[model samples]
Target chain A: MDNYPYAEQTDNELVRLSLSDPNQFLYLSKRYEDKLLRYITRISKFSRDEAEDVLQEVFIKTYYNLNGFDPDLKFSSWIYRIAHNETISAIRKKVARPTVSLDSEDLKNFTDSFDLSRDLDKSFDRKLINQALSKLDDKYHEVLVLRFLDEKDYVEIADILKKPVSTVGNLILRGKKLFKEEYNKLIINKNTK
Target chain B: MKNKNISQIVLERIKGEKIKPISRRIFYIKKVLFWTVVTLSLIIGSFIFSLILSGLFNNDWDLYDRFGFNFIMKTLPYFWLGSFLIFTILGEYYYRKTLLGHRLRYVIVIGFYMISTIIFGSIFYFVGIGDVLEKSFIDISPVYRNIILNRINFWSQPEEGLLSGIVTKIGNEEIEVKDSNGLIWSVNINGASNRNQVNLFVDEKIKITGDIIDDSLFVADEFRSW
Candidate 1:
């Protein structure tokens, strides 16, 4: 047991070993900490502390349900799914805080795909983008965050949201339309004021 | 609660609770059992629906003696129809809980149950299984017979229109008949133009379609023994 390098192991291997030696579970948790923290903040607009609280619960639930995890699913997707649900539950308990912080890198990556033809890299700042994002319904907002900021594909978003892939695609398209409409309206209001 | 490290907190929580993942075999076994129940419910539900349809289609709609179209509508076997709807909803619920079912859109899931019901219903009706189930349900359950199924008893009620039973006495113009409900009626065949076809013999089970003139008197229009 001393000779085995648990740190170098794959997630699946770590899961198997964690059953025998529970301490081996640490590696799996360590792998997703930063990503999950960012995910919670992005989805729920939670403060750093609130996101940490939700992250802790997510990890705890994951450990408890480890045996129930289907081996056929990717470990990353499963963990993200748990994180997604926990964040939603936490938000449901409290009135949602405004969630508007667009990562410039993410915006750059998805600008072309979203058909925001303007050179968003030069013109759009975080505050305006976040304001427009906040105007969307919760469902539309959630999908936009997952698709653009999280950079998840339709299948992964489907897995996390527990919806059909086709539904995820439809949500993104609708979200994009709403996002553009809201953003344009904001710009018009600002000019008149 | 002071822990800044996520992994350490999770490990501590698991150690405190002594939590372990459930065995994979148990999960698979439960899934299989759930699927089996869904399939059986689908089959039984479809068969019941077919029975209701069969009863409706096999009836003599033209027998409008006393109980006209309104009588037929009132006795349209809604008990089986209600049961079919209930089971279809349950089947859809169970299907949605499955792994593959979770991936399907709502329309597709609903469409699956609708298609399954039609296909299985046709098979059940074609093989006479639906009729057998309908007859057995009425024969076996008194609760069903007296409550829900009894509404269809209009088809057997002499007062409502049609009655079937044994011919206890045969006269030249009228016959004394004992209906399935064990009520006796003096059926008048003299007025029927098809009186020659209204042949009655003693101790024979027969169906007499006509109008009830009084509590004990029924005017017969048609009679058949099968």
Candidate 2:
């Protein structure tokens, strides 16, 4: 894996270069490829290959619509928005029930966000947290994933989802509360069983 | 396949397939189009709002006392009001299509739209554009006059002592008027009150309230320009 000589360039600068020479788009797409793949896998039931297919489509569409990118917005948000829409469309086409697939790092991020004790048995807590997240509505689950796991702020989440910042704030607050309640309910059910 | 470089693959696919970025002009045109629709909607909404104001201001409020709430309801500019609402919604929709338009809440957008239309509409109203538009619409569509301005139909009842028409001839104490229904009536305005502040002239539309002396004669107690 060679070091990208243009890695230091700003996204806007890269976008400008990409517009002039299609090869410059390599750096831009490479920058978002891993992140978008993880996002697609997190929000949908696609396998890694399927998620990569979606990511490839996202890159192609993003390149095709490069002229439409508003310079006022962060390139990451714009690309993520494209990735999000493509993943959702793919999910709809596949008719697969969408679910969150949290890995170890994502679980740690989620638990750390809520200040849950790290001392707890990791596997059990991971299962409980994943079940709680799965139980949430798509709106709540998406926001929680973006805010806690992806580490996006309210404004970025709002831009990615094309919702109002205030709505994003409210969703995060309500999502956290709902997640805790669901986690507790799951724990109680597990204890009884 | 799992170990393949996706970006490289996508880049090669791009090179092979000859996919090009859509022209910036298309996006520019789309953005301009959305803004154009929004501006046109706002302008049209302001005009419609101005017409609404004109309708309300030009209405005979004194007749409201005699005719009651039904007269007020019948004379309201529902057509203009409906048009204003449609333009307002269209303005909001197109505004949302603009870049960063989604950042604001619907209430904020709608509130801003309402305030803009009100301010500009009032300006249009005070400048008399509203009246001109109303008159033009009336001229263009008789249905508009008959349906929206039912006041015309209400005033055309000669048997009920309410009459309106264009003045065709003037006499020492009488004016020959042609009503909307094409019936000519000789109106005696010798002692009629002009508290309504109407200027009498040939070809002026006038409304009268009084007794019907005969099929072609009406003695008015009050007369006002319509």
Candidate 3:
């Protein structure tokens, strides 16, 4: 795999190459496979197999729409946008509620992002955080996941969601405040119980 | 599932299924089509705006005292106003379909659309397109002249002491005018004030505020060229 060429090429260059040779798309898909798979699982209720199936579709769609890719936008944002749409569509078709399935690393990233690292030391607090996130509105939950776990900038999130940048900024701000309120509510309920 | 390569699998499916990227020309055409709709909406919206201005400006504001507020209501261009609003909304919708269009907020897009319409509409009005368009519509469509331009019907009521028509003949102190309904009335202009300050000539369209002396005669108190 190390001997394979084109690993160092930028996404945009890979896209151009893939347009001429369909096999070159493998490099582009490989680059985004893990990231998009994780994104799909985090933002949806899909099992690992289902998430992988969705990721495969995302890659296929990305290749099928390669001619329509806008040069002005980053390829990463474009691919993420496709992944987000596909996951949401799959969830809708199955009539399943979207749930955030953050791994240990994602949980740590979320806590560190909000300066709640001390709370992460307790295993119970991690469950509470997960429950709180699952309880949030889909709008707030998606933005929080993109901003904190995925570590995307406001502009990138806006591009991925196809929303105005200012709107994305306001959503992130409001999402953080809502997340704190939900987390605190969960802690109080657990103590009372 | 643990060792399977998703990329290789997808690539194999693409090869087997013969899937190809949609042509770049299709996307380009779609973008161009959306922009064309946006442009047409803006232009049509501006023309409708100009027609609205023409209707308002050419309205008989001096008769407000006689006809009261109802006259103002009756003369307003509600049809053009409605059309302008429809086109404005359409312009915003199609503009959003363009690339990078969602980057701007609704307020910004609508505000820009309104400003462009006003600027262009004002230019169209000053260039006399509004008046010409209005006349053409009135000539071609009786529904427009009678219903939409209710001002004409409002003034053609001779028995109610308001009348308008084209001058067919001029006498010493009376003019024979053919009303919108094809009835000719002898308008006695002996003591009538010419508010428009224009000389009355044959085939000139005029509005008269006066009284009905008889079935065929109307004594004018005031008159103006339309």
Candidate 4:
């Protein structure tokens, strides 16, 4: 994956480049941006316009403060902090705005499996994943996002959320429980149909 | 509603847009300034510690004798440069209410530094060009190697009839030799020193020719009892 562009260099080497060569910090950006956007999008429940805008702000912050980054913490943890704050901000903005959609289709788009296969020539549809993600709470949703989508380890999740490893673990367990409960609700409805 | 399908769809939508680039110039300037301040503060702290130690302990201690100090000095400039670079590129992740995000910057910097050093060090070591590497954790200095290799030059001794007329002082694998003209030379007594080396004791005048290593010690290859 493009996630680790400088695979030969250790995270430390990349960090040096980030601090000394700001442009090099793009390694971090390229690696994290997609996953971060997904995470924010999931957390913020923003439509395309809102999520994209929030993502831009997050990146701007990441790039600007790139030098201040210490390599001691996992890169993902730092990025998550930005994403988390950005998502919160976006959510606040949505709360303030008058535009609201009651229907799930109007609130966000779903992947049209048939259309995606025909047009994008891709096998997977992201909209379905987002729905399932939305069904989970901040705790479970975020942990799942970090673990599967973002591919960050538990330690990194703990660090990103500023919780202890055990706390992060507990969140993951409870989150999974909640997600299972919610996932069953959606699936049961789909089966009835 | 399958979990796998949901994950795939979520990933795609997240990948939906290109993240906007931040203003590079403004961001980097601030980055450099911030890191410069951090490095300088660290150096200032270390310098103070060093000063305190100098005043308190052995004032006559040579500065370069410490390995940790050397490490700090070597990497200090890189820290400043790296900070400057980061300041110019990303600007601010966010200022207020985003202290966690701000702290994350340090994490990234440190992570990169560690990973890079190991990669570079390993590459340099395996490629057989480590000898030319500018910075290293491995002791690449030749003096240490040479001392361990050609280590026979530490004492003076008498062995054969050849050591005649040379007085020998012996102690701990070392011997001091004085010839008829009273010229003293210290040489090492080593069995593995070299082929045909000599050994001797006190009051035994030995005639021998010795080689000096940097005028510090001597190695005797030939000796005769006087």
Candidate 5:
């Protein structure tokens, strides 16, 4: 085995091994956890917390249905599929919950970190960008965020979303348009010197 | 647990306090169970198929001339599978609609039962349960195997039944029976704990109906009566 067990296996073999020896799937998690985590983190409008919860559900579900997958299919695509479903489900559950009460301190602190030039250190355009991202439809938000943040290819996003790769490409085009418009508006208003 | 806005949330929560990552025991058990299931289902499924042959075609079971003979025979694997699946689905549906519905993990947990059934079932079948069919099975003309499998795919199981039959042989986990017309039946009474003991003799008239699926035989949802 290579130092990186996941690095050596193809998605098909990983899934096959996952079926008989599920712990092998732990390799899958090691490989994709950060990537998928970032996916939900980005999709949930940089809400790493909600995204983390969503990621857990995705892994658990994947553990069980890993066999349900057809071997010919790509492993990353299948993992993304679960991520997409779990994210949508988590979002639904959240919408049903009473509004997310922002502790004034957290919001003020989060907002205070939003300065364009100074705060771009990490939470660049932090509060405002995240908030505007939250406003887009989940599908729109998810595609763009996964594309930019997760750096997944079009086929990967299509696999996650269970659409044709061409469909995903179109989604990115549309999502990017909306995202750029909203983003430009945010930067224009805040960064006008 | 932080209720702060989504940004504070990340990929950490997808993990639980305990990382029980499918222990070695479970992994081994899963392999054992899987083979055991495939083996047992093959055996059970073959027996069920013999009965089906008796029911569908009287004596000679000669399927050489049939257009779908190969298709029906190739389906030999799925009957075992369909039987297992149909039973699990029905059992859960029955339990929920009848009495034991409060199980939050009911659906996912039922899947575990399936893995166990497949491993053990395959084991039994592989261990020489139907040696007689070896000639008729392997020697099966490839043309017929595909046809038989195709035929089997079209049939499903009933949810309940008034199947009257006499018990022929009882095993550690299954019940064998002879229907009124002199056909064999393998009634898996493994999960029927709440029901009355179904003992079949040479002429014990009986009818039974429940969602019983055998991953090795066929879908039980189509098993309304037998």
Candidate 6:
């Protein structure tokens, strides 16, 4: 395993190799850990420890079910789906803890595009955006995060959520509509105060 | 450092756990077999449902004018329709489990089923599988036949000019029948034009179409085994 160039291997190649050489699975785990951990935290609002526990379970489950993974799908989308399922199950066990911790760099990019976009109010800032997101239902919130923050396309989002691409598009559309409405309501309340 | 540590933890968990993957070929074969069974059952169920509908409409609906809506509804096969609905619901479940079915929109899924049922129903009717399936069920299980087919025995009516039942007593002039509704009807087969064809026997089910002489007696103008 040490002599082989695991870093240069594609995800599919890594998966195929990992089946025979179990130690080669480490490279796959290292590849997805950061991205999946961040995703778990963002989606479920889990603490670092809770997210890590869920992430560990996700990877372990992924390893066991590696044969079941459809090779036609993107590896990232498939792994994210397992993470999404684990996070949802964890949330069911423990009440969702909505933490407002956006990646500053990602937030900057979002704000820049949000300012140019017509769906959201231009006057909104990160704090107001977070408040609106918290107000939205879990379904809308998950779609919005996967779309803008994770930057997954419609098909990728559909694979992760196990829904139709059209449904993902509709959810994003509805999410934007609801986010704007919620943000405006918050602005009104703040002004009255 | 923390990220690598969690990755190691995950790796350790995988190592400790039993991670035997089922052979992909076997997994897919099982899925295909399960889907095939579901599809075949759905086709048969839809065919049977179409037969019931075809049988109902094949009759002279002019009887509806005399019998009214309640009689028509009561005579319609509810059991067959219920089976059709059950199979349709199961078909939706298996359909959504497929790769293409998962990717389809809800509206498209529903539209697909509606179109499929229409196509299958028509093919079953035109191919005559509909009547064959219905008859086969009746022949295979008399208990099932008595319970399901007997409910919509539209042949059992003397007041509206059709009566059918098992022959309880075959007399020299009159044949006694235990009607579907359990009434003993005396059918006057003597001197009828089809009296020669009215070969009567005890315990054999038969249909008689004629004028009702009274509550318990019918003047048989036509007679045949039910």
User: What tens-digit string does per-residue lDDT give for candidate 4 at A1-193?
Assistant: 5535585666557656756555455565555555665666555557766666676667666655665565667666777877887777777766732121223432223223113344434343234444555766666766766655455777887767765566677777786566445545555665599
Q: For every candidate, how close is chain A to the native chain A in TM-score?
A: 0.86, 0.94, 0.94, 0.68, 0.71, 0.89
User: Which one wins on DockQ?
Assistant: 2
Residues B108-127 of candidate 6: C-alpha lDDT, one tens digit per residue:
76666656776888788778
| lDDT of model 5, residue B212 | 42
Question: Which ranges of candidate 4 are over 4 A from the true structure?
Answer: A1-7, A96-133, A190-193, B1-226
The candidate 5 chain B region of ten consecutive residues with least summed lDDT is B217-226
Please state the error at residue B20 of candidate 1 in Å.
Answer: 2.2
Model 1, residue pairs in steric clash: none
Task: List the candidates' TM-scores in order.
Answer: 0.84, 0.93, 0.91, 0.37, 0.38, 0.85
- RMSD values for the candidates in order, in angstroms, are 4.2, 2.5, 2.7, 18.8, 18.8, 3.9
DockQ for each model: 0.48, 0.62, 0.60, 0.04, 0.06, 0.56
Candidate 4 residue lDDT tens string, B75-137? 233332443345323323222122233334444644544444435444544554333332121
What tens-digit string does per-residue lDDT give for candidate 3 at A123-163?
A: 44677888888888988889999999889998888888888
Where does model 3 exceed 4 Å of error? Answer: A1-4, A117-124, B1-3, B157-160, B212-217
The CA lDDT at B137 in model 4 is 15
Q: Relative to the unseen true structure, what is the Cα RMSD of model 3?
A: 2.7
What is the fnat score of candidate 4? 0.03
Q: What's the distance in Å from true for residue A169, model 4?
A: 0.9
Give the better candidate number (4 or 5) by lDDT: 5
Docking level of model 2: medium
Every candidate's lDDT:
0.75, 0.87, 0.88, 0.49, 0.51, 0.75
lDDT of 5 by residue, B24-120 (tens): 5654565555555544544454454443333233211232343256534543445434654665565444333321122224645355545554454
Candidate 1 docking band: acceptable
Where does candidate 1 chain B have its weakest 10-residue lDDT segment? B191-200
Question: Regarding TM-score, does 5 or 6 come out ahead?
Answer: 6
Model 5's CAPRI class is incorrect
